[model samples]
Each structure stands twice: as C-alpha cells, then as structure tokens.
Target: MTDRHNAFLSDMAEATRLTQSGRLGEATALIQRRLGVPGRSPDGASPADASAGPHAVPRLEGPAARLGTEAAAATAHEALIPERLRENIDQMMQGLRTLAPSLRGLVGGGLHAPKPGGLEPEGVETEGGQFVERSFSNAAGARDYKLFIPSPRSGPRPLLVMLHGCTQSPDDFAAGTRMNALAEEEGIYVVYPRQSSRANAQRCWNWFEPGDQGREMGEAGIVAGLVRAICTEHPIDRSRIYIAGLSAGGAAAANIARAYPDLFAGLGVHSGLAAGCARDLPSALSAMRVGAPGAAEPGGAAGFGAGSVTQNLRVPTIVFHGEGDGTVHPRNADAVLAQAGIDALTPRRERGSSGRHSYTRTRYADETGRVQVEAWSVQGAGHAWLGGSPEGSYTDPSGPDASRAMLDFFLGHSLPGGRG
Candidate 1:
C-alpha cells in the first residue's frame, strides 16, 4: 500500500478513536477532510495542505488505492466510496454508540466530492447553458447527478433524464449524445444520473438486480427521488418529463418508466432490453444474446411482479437498435415495444442516411393516432449512440441522430391529464 492509502486508513482509525471519545464533531470533520472536501482540519490546516504534510501517506498501488483517489476526487455529491471503505466506516461509526444523529448521518450519508476538474464538457460551449452538480438521497439510497439548464427560459421547460451506459460518465455521455447542444437549442433541461463503480464494477445500473427493478426500491427509487427533487427545485413541466438511456442505461430507463409511469411522460431506449428481461447476471446475458421471450409479459415466469410489466398505462416509448449490434441483439427492440403493449399495426417506414450508415425507422401508433412506440434499425451500425460525436465512446457518427429524434418524440407527448 502507498503512503496515501495508509494515511487514509489511519485517518479512519483516528476518526474512530475520536468518535468513541464522544468528539463526534471532530471525527466528522476529519472524515470530511480525508474525503478531500474543502475544510479546515483539527490542526487548523486546510485539507490540501494537511495531506501534503508529514502525517500524510503517499498514494498506494492497487485497485483500492485507485478507488480512494477517485472517490476523493469525484465531484458528484453522492458519489459512493468503495464498498470496503464504506463498510469499514460504518463499523467504526457503530462503535461510537453516543455519536449525535446528525453527525452519524454525515459520516454515513452520501457526501459531495467535487471533481478535480470542472463538470462541464471540454470544447463544448452551450453559450447560455449552465451545468450544476447535485445529489439526492432517500430510504432506498443516495445518488449524484448533473443537471443542465439551457438559456432564455420563458416558462416552465421540459426535463429530460439521461442515464449513461456502463463505464460512461455523465460528461462522456453528454459529449457522445451531444444532447446538451440540442437542449440549448430547444431550451430544455437535461439531467444525468451517474452510476458508481462501487455499485457495479463496470459502473452499470443494477437493472438486472431484483432489488433495483421495483418501484420505490433500490436504484429505481433513488433515481425517482432524484427526479422529484429536481422538479421540486426547478420550474420543470411535470407533464413533459422524459427519460432515456443507452445499453444498460437504456434497460434502466425502461425499468424506471415501468415502475413510475406517472412520473415520466415518455421514454427512449437505445440498444437495451425490456424491464424484467433478466433477474440475474446469467439471465441478463441470455436476454441480451437472443432476446428473452415473455420476459416483460405479465405473469411470465421471468417477470419480477405484476407491476414489473406495464398494465394500466402505456409509456410512450421510442427504441433504437443497430441491426449489427453484437452486444445487444436487434430483437430486443421488438421486446421493448411489446412490453409497452404496442401492436404491430403497419408501421410508417422512413429511411435516412448520415455519412456512411443508413437507418430505417418504423413508427407504431395507437388507435388514437398517437405514435406510442417507434423503432429505428440502423443498417451497418453497431452498438453505439447513433450520430453521436466522436469525442465520447460507444458512438457511431454515421448513424441517424438519436438525440434529436428522442427529443422530438418526447416533446410531442405528455401525461394523460396533461398536468404540467
């Protein structure tokens, strides 16, 4: 272990000692400093200066060390520390039976850790757009998310919840989708919820986990709480709230929409499976390989519950999948439509080309003539964000622009009562 790792561990031990002695305030401050939050240490020195002093340990050499560094450097308010570190902290706190409730909350709660650099994407200017880092916590869990507000807002604007794929950050996803630029043009607000590596090794949303797939539970509940918090703080048109994601994030988006249909007006999924398509890792892999039949159907053996499959309401959904996507099969898009209770009643087909890739879009509408679900099958495209910028990963700049299409579809629909 490097000196820094040792110092971090040692700091934890010292905090435990302080807590046991009933000096909870001091203990909390120490922990905050160790987390790299800007604060004064007990010795009257700044956290940065204290870390470089003789008592500070050098950085370690391992995954644990890397996690510590990342956790300290993370800007997201709810960014989670490594599970092992969290467990240790929890145990230490437990030993301090007399610690104040608020102090304990600070130690155990999701705290903010500002990123070493700014949260804004590099080389991309929104002109009048603003990016803010925020956190939301509830009984389910806590999460850190970024919100983008476009300039020149005359009234309550629409809100778009963008979930990132596995191994992708909010900044990276924003860059790849170029959604910020679109939001600026449309005067919309965009929010991106970041998944922690501690949550999943690849930083994928726990969509496949039973604990996370339900309403008011796990990741779903946390994200919903975040949405509620954002709406409460911003002048969001509740009727126009929408959610979309890519890959694992796409699957998560489906899960969120299914669980909280009233909260979201529509959904956009890219290269993703339907909700409850898998209950575990093995089943998730199976679902991705050939598509899980009846995975989203009511009362199916693989179904999570009755609520897992949409019953009363059909969330307006738009799906995009590349025919050549090897990571997630194209048939999964059909499964998504089926889960939304959309019937294959003669789709309006449209073909388009961007640079080298061509795509075929088929729109499926309900009896009322409202397009409930649409699928885009990009020819010769792989598993990537269609027409995304090259600055980010998992993007094909040649395919149809998914961000623009999704925004157009989202703005067209609202809740049944139209209550914005």
Candidate 2:
C-alpha cells in the first residue's frame, strides 16, 4: 500500500491498543493531535468550555468513566472500526493492491466505492413537475443537473438549488428530500446538480479542497455559473434564490454561499461541516470525526478556527443536525452558524417534538428583529436526513419535515430591496 494509507493504518492500530487499555481519552487525543485537530475530545465533545492543552485528553465522567474505554469507544462508533477492518481484511488487502492504479482520488470518500450505481430517474413520471435533465459548462468545469420546473407561472418565482451528499445522485436526492413535490405546491423551482465520479469516486463535492473552496473557481464556481444560467433561462426572482444540501453537499452549499453572497439570499446545511473546516484528506477525516478544531467557540467574528468567512455580507442560514450523528459530529452544526457570522448574536431558543424526535430550535435575529439564522438540534437522530423518504439513501422519516421548514425559512428572507 501507499505510505499515506500505511501511516493511517499504523496510527489507527495504535489507537485501538489505547482503547483496549481503557485509555480511550488518550487514544482520541493522540489521534487528534497527530492529525493536527487537537481541539476535540474523546467522545466528540465540544471544547468551547474546556480549559486544556491542545493535546490534553479530558477525563470521562459518570457512566462513561465507569464503563472504561472499550464500551465508550464502541458506543461512539470508534470501537467497531477494528472489528470491521478485521472482517474485511482480505477484501481490503486485495482492493488496496489495485486501488493505486484504479483510484485517482484519496479523499472525499474515495478510499472505496461503497455505493455502486449511476444516475437513476429523478422521480415517478406522475410527480407533476417537469424534472428535466440539463447540463451547464463554464470556465471552471462542466456539470449535469436536473431542473424541476413548477408548471407555468405568471411572474418571477423563487428558485432553490439542492445539493446531494456523497455517493448520491440528483435522482436519489430529489426522491429522498421530496423537494420537487414541494416545489409544485409552493410554486417555486428546484434544481439538483449531479457531481461527476471523475471529480471524486464517491461523487462527493470537494469541499475539503482549497481549490474548490474559493470564489469563481473549482466546484463553487461551476455551481454558481449553473445558478446564473438557470436564472437567465428561467423566470427566477433574483431576490429569493436559496441553496441547501446534506453532508458533503451541505459543506459545498456553505462554501458557495460564502463565495457568492450576492447570488444566494439564504443557505441551509444539514449534518455538514463549515466551509474551510478541512483543507485535505487528513483534516477532513479529523473534522468529520470530532469537528473542526476550535469549532467549540461559537462567538467568533473571524470565522471559526478551521473556517474562513470574511464577507461583511452574511447570508441568512438555517442549520439542522442530529445530536447522535456519528459520521459528522453535532458540534459542526454550531460551527456552521459561526462561519455564517451569526453565532455571536444571542438566540431565542425553544423546545419542541416531532412525535418521533425531540428538537431544540434556536433563532438568531438582527437588531431590526429579523431572524437571520435558525438552528435545529434533533435528539436520538443519527446520520440520516430528518423526515426524508426511505426511497432514497441516508434518510430517516422519523423527524420534523426538513424540506418544509427550510422552505418556510427561505421564503421569509430575500435580498435587501427585493420582494420577499
């Protein structure tokens, strides 16, 4: 295997030993410090309130302390990794032999091709909206997309751009989120952009890459260009344009919103890290595990430690995250708000339930009493889309309808002088 993969294996093996010896805290801290993300703790705990060294491991408490390291790590999904590795050792070895030649990507879920398939139908033909397949090419690159036109409208209508997660296509995402159906009801247009496998094997947006993170370049630039083209071709209101996504797609949405503040009026991120949270594969792994280092602090004007959002113009944003998410830490939800430059503002918090899950909703408002940011923290939810359909992958239909909530929030805000 290559040196990078070899190094990762060696480091993880050592971490396994540390867990076996009831040194879970040390193991987590070791990995974080070694990987250059020492701000997070053993159990993906936020470090905003902790006063410790970057390499310091916080002591476990109560039940976790009593259970020792093994149970703790197991509950956190870190312990099963070794077992999974052992079970797939033979296949993994064989794949590793040919991976160097077949795979040109090492990051953004490129280590393996877990989900195998190409494009599928956007939805049933009876869905009522025209889900047309289209393509857009710009100076940066070319991408294929599916646009859902909501019948014929008299005046300009709102438009929403939806980005899919890693290993997901526009069809699966549209089916899962059921956004097209909602678009027909709200009289708004929706678009789903397809990520090319050539860019990343898993079809994940390269949000962790520096080239893709900047304005007017890379993936962000292509997405922005697509939006502009859609606006020019369709009767879309310039004031009410918005974008939302899940996982890697959510990260890309944040980057796109930050880069082109004038193009998008609102942003939505579900189970995603903030833009600039990771610069490469190692940091991306670290951020997904614990969170971006220094994300614990919510009151930062200089963009969280790992992210950089320098625009004085803030894009109104709404965020959703499950507290029990193991793939991406819940702390990342907070980092998203901070990166949007709204975490410094005090929020009005409320508690509610969606029958299946209890959630905490926090809203931040400007001095004029207009809400600029909203966050939802769902309890007992994992790494799936809340209230999404099972027809698509990575969806849990057990929580509040995220599509409805996001649509309402998006409709509530518009550009400074445009119609809301």
Winner by TM-score = 1
Looking at model 1, which ten-residue stretch has the lowest summed lDDT?
54-63
Tens digit per residue, CA lDDT, model 1, 87-127: 66567568544443444333332223322322222212235
lDDT of 1: 0.72
Q: Each prediction's TM-score against the native?
A: 0.70, 0.68
lDDT of each residue in 123-173, candidate 2, tens digit only: 222345576665667888877787888877679999999999876788879
> What alpha-carbon RMSD in Å does predicted model 1 have with respect to the real structure?
12.5
**Would you list the C-alpha lDDT of every candidate in the order shown?**
0.72, 0.72
Candidate 2 lands at a TM-score of: 0.68
The deviation in Å at residue 305 for candidate 1 is: 4.4
Query: Which residue pairs collide, candidate 1?
Result: 2-60, 3-57, 3-58, 4-57, 4-58, 75-114, 75-115
